[model samples]
Target: MALAPEPGPDWSAALSHLVLGAVSLHAAVRSAPASRGAAAGFLLQALAATCTLAPGLGTREDCPSGAWVATVIGLPLLAFDFHWVNGDRSSANLMLGAGMALAVAGEHLGPEGCSVAGQAVLLVVAVTIAIVAVFTANTYGVWGGALLGAAGLLSRLDEDGLPLRRGDACRWALAAGSWAYCRALRTQRLQWE
Candidate 1:
């Protein structure tokens, strides 16, 4: 039997990313001047998502690298912003930055390497966010951290051609985490104002 052609790009995933990106943009626009760093991280995600929204401009295969690069850079910015927003300079920001650096290095090693790198980035970002959440006493932030970590784990354990693929799970987790984080950012802004 002749092999059927593969399906086109996943429109749902792209749409979700676009929506999340828009939410992030709104948060950024509402944030104060100094706190815009966190919003900047989300903006990168938005940019990556926008690129993927166009089938001709960026196919799925072309999007992950952009997404990964954005995540790699964005997570630390968010972490550092938290550090400044909370007015508590912890060495954890340094560690988070180092972790992102390592993830970037690992991504260059190949698919397995990229998977591991992605996992590490997610874990570090999760842990950092969790720390910030604890300091802020924001329960939603804690859940956001958990979701991000779970997404990382799911991505790492994902295999090819599963009925419920890892990418879908990760996307859901990311969306939830992003929403929670956005809420947390809002709370932080309110507290400071």
Candidate 2:
């Protein structure tokens, strides 16, 4: 009998990096401050949404338009980071900014050169991070992030194989994260009121 082809390095690295990154981001957001940290957390959730959406419209090559979209999305995120860092934002904001910067670095490293598995892993990581951010941030941010991450994960599954729906799990995590944020916010509001 013929043996199955071994998965490439890109696949393993992508998934591993994503999971690790998510864990790191989650920790960073948890310790972040209320103002800019919350904004940075939302930005991460937005990134998760973008990764999920990118695949469905077309492959990276087929859609130059997508690159434009990426630029538009990326610029504001960078600005957000800069603001957080330079404006004497909280240490939590700085940490969140650092986490996002790391994620962007990972994306640049992976790019089109990475294998399909690698891309899937990246999405998984993104969703995981977004979920964590949601729980640490506000209700609106959590809900929006969860929805976007879910859509992204679903699209990613369509491209890759079905046996492991890691993307889907990430989306559910986002939802859970959102729920956590909502509960936290409600509690806070009740105390204030």
Candidate 3:
């Protein structure tokens, strides 16, 4: 028997991701030499968003959990870029290692088998990014990271517990967070210039 058709994908959320990716790609290209690390981080983030949009845009059959993993790996790159600017490389290597470890753990957990754990990993990375942003006085980063963390939490909520689908809420928050992150990159590029 033929299976029922799935609902159409969230077009607004997909559009936001597309915008985020484009802006981030622009940031990566326009960043100054001293801000190459941040540019690289932006590029990685863009890749993550691209992964998220792939299924929705019909480039893939399903969303890859690699999006979260990539975000996890990219967080420390951003956190350390500012740290490096401040002449503090002592914890940069350690954080980078930790980010990689977290990415591996998140991947192993698998969103289907353990969505909460996967989302929790996303929360951890997002919170770390927010904390780092606060320390660095990056307003956009602080808000963006917080929104991303909120999205993670929202995604874990039961569908029956809310008036609207939790997935929709999560997607809206994720898209907003992505826009904020793109703004963060823009601000960082300006500082570098």
Among these predicted structures, which one has the highest TM-score?
1
Clashing residue pairs, backbone N/CA/C < 3 A, model 1:
none
lDDT tens string, model 1, 126-162? Answer: 8988988887798877888998888788776745745
List TM-score per model, in order: 0.79, 0.33, 0.65
Tell how far residue 142 is off in model 3, in angstroms.
Answer: 2.5
- Each model's lDDT comes to 0.72, 0.42, 0.66
Ranking by TM-score: 1, 3, 2
Residues 1-193, candidate 3: write the lDDT tens digits. Answer: 9999999977766776686667666656755354676677768767866776654653452345545554666656766665555456776666667767766776466557446654655676577667767876789989988988888888777888866577557656765775676576566556656
Per-residue lDDT of candidate 2, residues 1-193 (tens digit): 9999987555432453354335325533553454343434434543443442434745656333332223233223422332343343553344445444544554455555333433343344345434444544545434534554554455455535554455445444544543444344343334444
Q: Give, for candidate 1, the lowest lDDT window spanning 10 residues.
A: 25-34
In each prediction, how many residue pairs overlap at the backbone (N, C-alpha, C within less than 3 A)? 0, 2, 0
Runs with alpha carbons beyond 4 Å of true place in candidate 1:
1-9, 32-34, 59-61, 90-96, 99-107, 158-163
What lDDT does model 1 reach? Answer: 0.72
Candidate 2, superposed: residue stretches over 4 Å from native: 1-89, 111-164, 189-193
Off by over 4 Å in 3: 1-13, 16-20, 30-34, 52-62, 104-118, 161-168, 185-193
